[model samples]
Target: MERESSALLFIREKSVGFTARVALHEYKRQCDGGYPAKLKKVLIVTAPLWFKAPFRILRLFVREKLRERVHTVSAPQLGAHVPRASLPTQLGGQLAPDHAAWLEHCRNCYTNNLQNNKLDGVIDEYVISNYIPPVKTQNGVIEHEVARDMTSDRVARLEQPDAMHISDPPYTCDTGPLRHTHGYNGDMKGGHIHSGDEDEVDLITRGTWSSGEASPGLSDEECAGGGAGESAGALLARLRSLGRRGLVAEYEEIRARPPQGTFHHAKLPSNLSKNRYTDVLCYDHSRVLLSQIDPEDPTTDYINANYVDGYKQKNAFICTQGPLPKTYSDFWRMVWEQGCLAVVMTTRAVERGRVKCGQYWPAAAGARAVHPPFALLTEAVDVEDDYIISHLVLTDLRSEMSRRVWHGQYVRWPDYGVPGGGRAQPVLRFLQLVRRAQRTALADLGDAWAGHSRGPPIVVHCSAGIGRTGTFITLDVCTSRLSAEGVADVRGTVERVRAQRAHSIQMPDQYVFCHLALLEYAVMHGYLESADLNGFDDDNEDESE
Candidate 1:
């Protein structure tokens, strides 16, 4: 029994019968975990009513051998493999499905560290690290509550195996329902959150201004000199003259051209297929290549990332996707390999009821998550109104080499939309904070980050790594160009970025937002005044195009 390894997925027809999509997504999420490495086989026993349902689509994502691990069997078939005395009665076994009793047993295991302080055969401090009691809220009148009893129950039962392995400190109460019911934080209510349904109008809703003469900064040739010494009034007047519609038209012209380089082909077959979209690729010449962990194969070395050059600084960013559950280790590997000083996350891990990115780092101070040779420890966290700054230490367990990496999590900015109106100020402020930290790190640890005085290409990522990611980098590059050289070239910068990484600035609105945001930056820095910022309708911005 100690040597035997197995995993089970129970399908309660009464619970997930109608919602196949949710079931499949949940299944994929399970598959995304590190279970395949430990388990020799995974069994699926559905409710008696469920027929041999089509679950073959799952094979495409998992490894070829791991796919063979999955097996769908009936209740009677389960009894043949397991002793009736130990099996649950709900699935034709003698032991009754006593979840309440099971919870108590599991709680004891956590309360008393067993199996050499390793819970459920997995060695990790996560279960016991910072156990908190459930939040108790008394009922209030006229309160709106999303009833989640059924969903909560399903999750509790599904995770019973792993839950039994929790090894933590003393319990708040001796008895009660485990105090923890899966990882749900009560934000999402039903089904997978789709990004498509979100209201882009929640951002600044502004109208299209008539296209007049283009702004001096809009033209690549004119901007070659710089926007420096350009007065606040004059800058706003120039921006107002060019308008959103004209800038957007110019962006489309750049987008229409076929990408210049072929560096993106370095992506491996597996990594390419894993990407949410295909067109998003890393340009070959400037791509941030991952040092292969395995010498024999180079396919796995591919991480959908690239080295984007800053306005003046060469190789300013290691732009990549928001880490997937499977790519968590790889993402950290890239960070360590690239010698990055800071990680700037522009999108929330989950946004607008959808999983925009995986939760790649630890949630609190003193907590540690190990991705094999790399162990990420959250040393400290500073939560700002517009962004969260986490102090993380990455220790290479094998060589014992360690490095501190900063994570600037900006949550105010919507997924595909700009931080509009008053919101724009926070973004500018956030960028300053990130740059300040990088500068300070460079000055303090001079020789440690020797070559990267401007700091190693700060790892910037959103969901797709191109849309919001590209916009943020563009802002950083152009803003720096304006400050140092006195010019900000939207067309030139966007084209250069897309050259390194494909389909960079995602939509027309994002393209327009870049110009508007640059104008906002000018106003914030005294180059433009608040009153001078006119002809800008915060509510008239169009996303339909």
Candidate 2:
């Protein structure tokens, strides 16, 4: 078998230092102190901070410790070209002051250590290291995910497999993106293209994990080459059968209407408080724009402003073309300047020139000036990919779609300015926060629904605050209030939502997007149709596009 080898070395002669970060990577109890005969390939690195060692003796000891004894590097040695087996550090003053800190990160393992009988400042210490293994093990991350595709089995095998392992969910989450994003080409960037009701993008959603599952960072070629064991083509083909019916059931019209009933209309939880938001507009949810605004609507002006700097943010507004437009930029400016978030259409906001805000950015402000507190910038990835969503499901399923706006996550790109579109909202900073906070929220919501409800007269919004937001709200409410009622027509749900709010996503792409959103919600919770609700695997397959 042909194998490839790579190595990393770090050593600095100037301000030179040597440190060993040791961990029991593969431990067995056959006389614990014995050498690891099986560890044929090992990576060794030297730190940058200077420390004198009786290295002449210790160097020999380190060499003796290895079986194959492949990689070796020494700090403070330079002007030398050594074989692949060796690496030398540059001379003094060559390393960055933070090089040692960066080295600690290289080890990839974190721990607290006990130290005594040292200098006064030296005590027990917590340590972190980023040890890049010469070869990484399987724990793959998704590159790009769209509704029209699938993945490989070598892609599976989680530490402890569950629903999370079965499928990769979306990246949207409070804990930031639950999955790492690798490759994307803007297919889902502008917006989802409507594939027609009877036609859906074709692809596989699940795969079996045998041995040799791909690691998290392998390039696409490396992943494909990593044979994950062999399976029958028949089985693979069966899994690939295109499920033509909309992934989201078509509940074209409301089944039993709202029943004019006293639903969770009162039962929804008002768990959050007004004081919770010192600056209400500091973190704008994406649902707001997707549901409420339009370029033409005249009433979209937000009369309040509540945020940081807004005037110089370069955010363009759309409406009646007065002081503020009905655009999100205009409304968001108001949100940044004042505490007001108005319910209006995008066109109207644009026409107004400035969506009324209690506060406004200084005229000479930068985008960062009006930046929301919890907003984020991230590596973009399509949310519909199973691998991405499966990873999210493995992590925090509830937050997969709730946090960001109009499907686009706020991501940080330094020199590259943000891409613009009606549904777009800046949120990369918030994605980072979501990566950590979402899990707790999911645990709290239980399995009934993914998002925390407003309890009384709750509001759900996308960029327009109508289509995607309305659909999600409808599903969430029905799941919580009418789970017993068999799956209703999605179209019916949309119509009902429209009755409450006019012009709920007239765009075709937006319509398709609404269904996909529903699929994401249903699949994550193991509740796919009322029939499947009663503890049935229904592993039975075969769907056509």
Candidate 3:
């Protein structure tokens, strides 16, 4: 038997749609060199019949006639194919279970290979190894040749007859600009060129990264007027030059590394134990210290939250999960202690027939609530199409100090999913409001936002702080980077956020959505050519990875 020509997938009880897709993706991606010869007879042995459904969707994503070769059989049926001496006893054969040991050995071998840099050689063998010269730029704008090199070839390949008939892998997040195929009808240049609202545009300025020391081979001429100073056309062109798979691979590499110190104490209770309300905890180093709030009790010092720094901005946000009913007071106390000027709430109080978040704030204007040591007064409320803005006045009863906070609740973004590309206006509009509010508050502090101490972190929360919260923060930070530095690194931004808060951008789809959302934001703000923003379908968004 030619082992390279055949493959077997043994599906156990824990196999889900994500697992099946991952297996298929690995097989397809790894066997790309001679895929036609490989996997000619892929067989799946399972205990139940329902496991076959995931493979049906696999065809739509993998673009291969995998269903034709995929065969799912029960344990009783496995005996007919394998010799009685070779099969496991559970499958009515004499062999005992040894697959687990073999898998462990394979893992060790792969680890050794990776440490020896053999993995890179393997990848090099599979790839065409196009000579990507060190990119050169002029006046902060990428040279047309560089942009052409980055996009034209990929688009041309995608336009080939064989490629046009194929579909993307299942559960893939479509970051409009980074995908291999050209989604727009040939005319990439045709789109809305101007912004509808000039007042909402962000201030773009040259950033620290513009210095040659930070970016080697980039002279002042190459980065002049770069960052926020670059024109929208140049920025969009630069953004379109990135490889989607390369970005995904970098993100995966970051996830594979173990954290240096998990800060187990930062967790509300023991790390081993968890409840439905707070299953995850922030690491100690990145966690917000509230020891000053209640110096007497150490328990009061802890909250299920972490401080996430933004691009060129420290303590940009205090990311946390939805406040549990009991921790509502702690949540508010953190906001008050941290001097947060705005709260970016991405999830609704309830979602999909489940209590996703606590109704921590007052429902209507003029309503007042006393959550102990702090009293929250809802001064006013303004409801918009995609979100609600509330004027909240929080008074710290202990110090008799009162502060007004803007509560921006984005209602449309679903839990564990992303806001569709077509419906980006509301989210972008809401984000602008938040940024403006933060800027005004920072300005009032005079140098605090920029100098010795940074401005108060914006308190952002969702059902789980890591998913939608991470997505929102990533978009905000990347946009800010684009405005100040004229460039954005999606993978780097996500890695920074994750360093502060564990598991930021929870799944692969969320990670990809971050890119898509940024692209949508660019179009809305006239930074990118605006095509039919609604042409992209984010309806089936999944956090499979």
Instruction: Rank all candidate structures by their lDDT, best first, as comma-separated numbers.
Output: 1, 3, 2
RMSD of each: 25.2, 24.5, 25.4
lDDT, candidate 3, equals 0.54
Report the number of the highest-TM-score candidate: 1
**In candidate 1, what are the lDDT values of residues 1-545, reduced to their tens digit?**
11221233333433335443454555555655644323333455662333333454444466654554445544434432333323454544334444564455445545554533545554223232222222111111111122222234545653454332121111111122222322111212132111111212111111100001001012122223222335435546666776666666788888887654442233445556646556566643344545446645534556677766665454577778888777888888878766677899998887879999888899799999999768999999998777899999998887787888889998877866776553456777788898998886667664333242476668899888988888888888777766765557666677767755677888877887777777778766766557454555433455443
Q: lDDT of each prediction vs. the true structure? A: 0.56, 0.24, 0.54
Give lDDT: candidate 1, residue 254. Answer: 80
User: Which candidate comes out best when scored by lDDT?
Assistant: 1
lDDT of 3 at 346: 95
Off by over 4 Å in 1: 1-235, 263-267, 420-422, 530-533, 536-545
TM-score, ranked from best to worst: 1, 3, 2
TM-score of each: 0.55, 0.22, 0.52
Q: Backbone clashes in each candidate structure, one number apiece? A: 17, 145, 8
Better of 1 and 3 by TM-score: 1
State, as a TM-score between 0 and 1, how close model 1 is to the true structure. 0.55
lDDT of 2 by residue, 53-151 (tens): 332223334333331222232321111111111222122111123345434433222221212222233221211011111110011212222121112
Query: What is the Å distance of residue 286 in model 3 from its true position?
Result: 0.9
- Candidate 3 backbone collisions, by pair: 61-168, 61-169, 61-170, 227-484, 227-485, 227-486, 228-483, 228-484
